[model samples]
Target: MTTVTAPPPPAARTATPAPLVSVRGLQVAYGDGPLVLDGVDLDLFPGETVALLGSSGSGKSTLMKSLTGFAPITGGSAQVAGHDVGTLRRGRLRNLRADVGQVFQQFNLVGRLSVLTNVLTGALHGAGPVNAVGGFSSADRQRAMALLDRVGIAHKAKDQARTLSGGQQQRVAIARALMQRPRLILADEPVASLDPTMSHQVLDLLQEIARADGIPVLVSLHVLHLALDHSDRVVGLRHGEVLVSSPTAELDAERLAVVYDVSDADQEADDAGH
Candidate 1:
């Protein structure tokens, strides 16, 4: 007979390990369009949740995409899980993506599939299309079932994805991401479609996962208060640049207000015309 025990505390910040995801002087553009990310820099360390805060068009989504080579990286470098995203060829890029797990606002599930089956699909990331249908091994299925239990939705494993409520479905999405055994997790506005009550629950769960799994979670969020509540560090972007980056313990809504202040953008334009 055995009893579960909590793990020991992490080493001091000075002794913290190197970041799993590192971005430096990053830039992204889409075919003659203006730069969407300009000299952006970010880092995600293990056992931490970094809330990415910004209003619309702040380049939050682009930064996330650049990590896995989904965004066209025009300048600088992004090292994710030890892979240089900007320099990776197609074959290696696929490996880079397999190392990162992603969550979305829409909860992107195959509505007709069972929750368990959907989670199992995460194991298909590196496997070729040959295993897309009915090819999961017993170990993969066991892991998927365990992930569902970890996310607290094991009871709903047999339910159709379309039948679950918004919050429950999001939990399943998270379980699916965990199925990938991801080194870093990126959640793009995962709570945007959820109600306030559900929002807190989902965010709380993400933070818990970060701490327990020792995996860094970089979550983009539009709501300032939610970021304040759910993250260990806060990185706020404005007009494709990082306006503020600090530990959440040192920040408040007042300090974060500039990220959303439209007048700042107007002021920049005014100065540019000079």
Candidate 2:
């Protein structure tokens, strides 16, 4: 008789790095309007993908904007890459933005430029004014090509950005963001315009980048299933407040339903009319 024993279980995962982006009691509002984001707190750790979820007007976009200084913070603190977002001077703010890469729903790209050229533009985030005659350097061009290849679109590097399909255009946008070597990535509704398949592909790519580069990716998403399927953590907002924050493995559609619940007035009105 021979005795067999299974190998001991692997060691528990190491503690995560200090948060690259931190927010506490964050509040935001437009002039004279009600608070768009209220009493929100969030922390983004390196090599993690966090999904922001909410229905329309739920403050998801406002929260993302606050992280980059686009939204006015009425109270609380938001620190990104060691800079206090609300109190940073203009130059420091520019430096902060340079360290943070952004992807938008619209795939903000210059349609007329070649995909490679568009990616190179990412290097301009914190760069001084360029000499029109000198243009991009050989090193910058090579780096841009490499990023395009990483995104699986090196073949489209020579094509006009406008000529590619929606998925392809998004790949170009992602490559462009990577060209910045960002410490944090903010993706605001990044896949809202894509079909279901493209949505999965794009989200998968974002998570891969987060893990491989040790960058924190905070992406706002409308689809519940997508968040559950792609993100490591989920933060749900409702009526300008955080309603839920937990690991994706511990959450499901039932647990998230409260984030999008209808108001009492609406429900009563429906019953009265019936």
What TM-score would each prediction reach against the true structure? 0.89, 0.89
* Deviation of model 1 at 15, angstroms: 1.8
Candidate 2 TM-score versus the reference: 0.89
Once superposed on the true structure, which residue ranges of model 2 sit more than 4 Å away at CA? Answer: 1-13, 129-134, 263-274
Q: Please give the distance, in angstroms, between residue 129's alpha carbon in candidate 1 and its true position after superposition.
A: 7.7
Instruction: Write the residue-wise lDDT of candidate 2 on 184-245 in tens digits.
Output: 99999999999988999999999999999999999998778888888999999999999999
Distance from true position, residue 20, model 1, in Å? 0.7
Full-model lDDT for every candidate = 0.90, 0.89
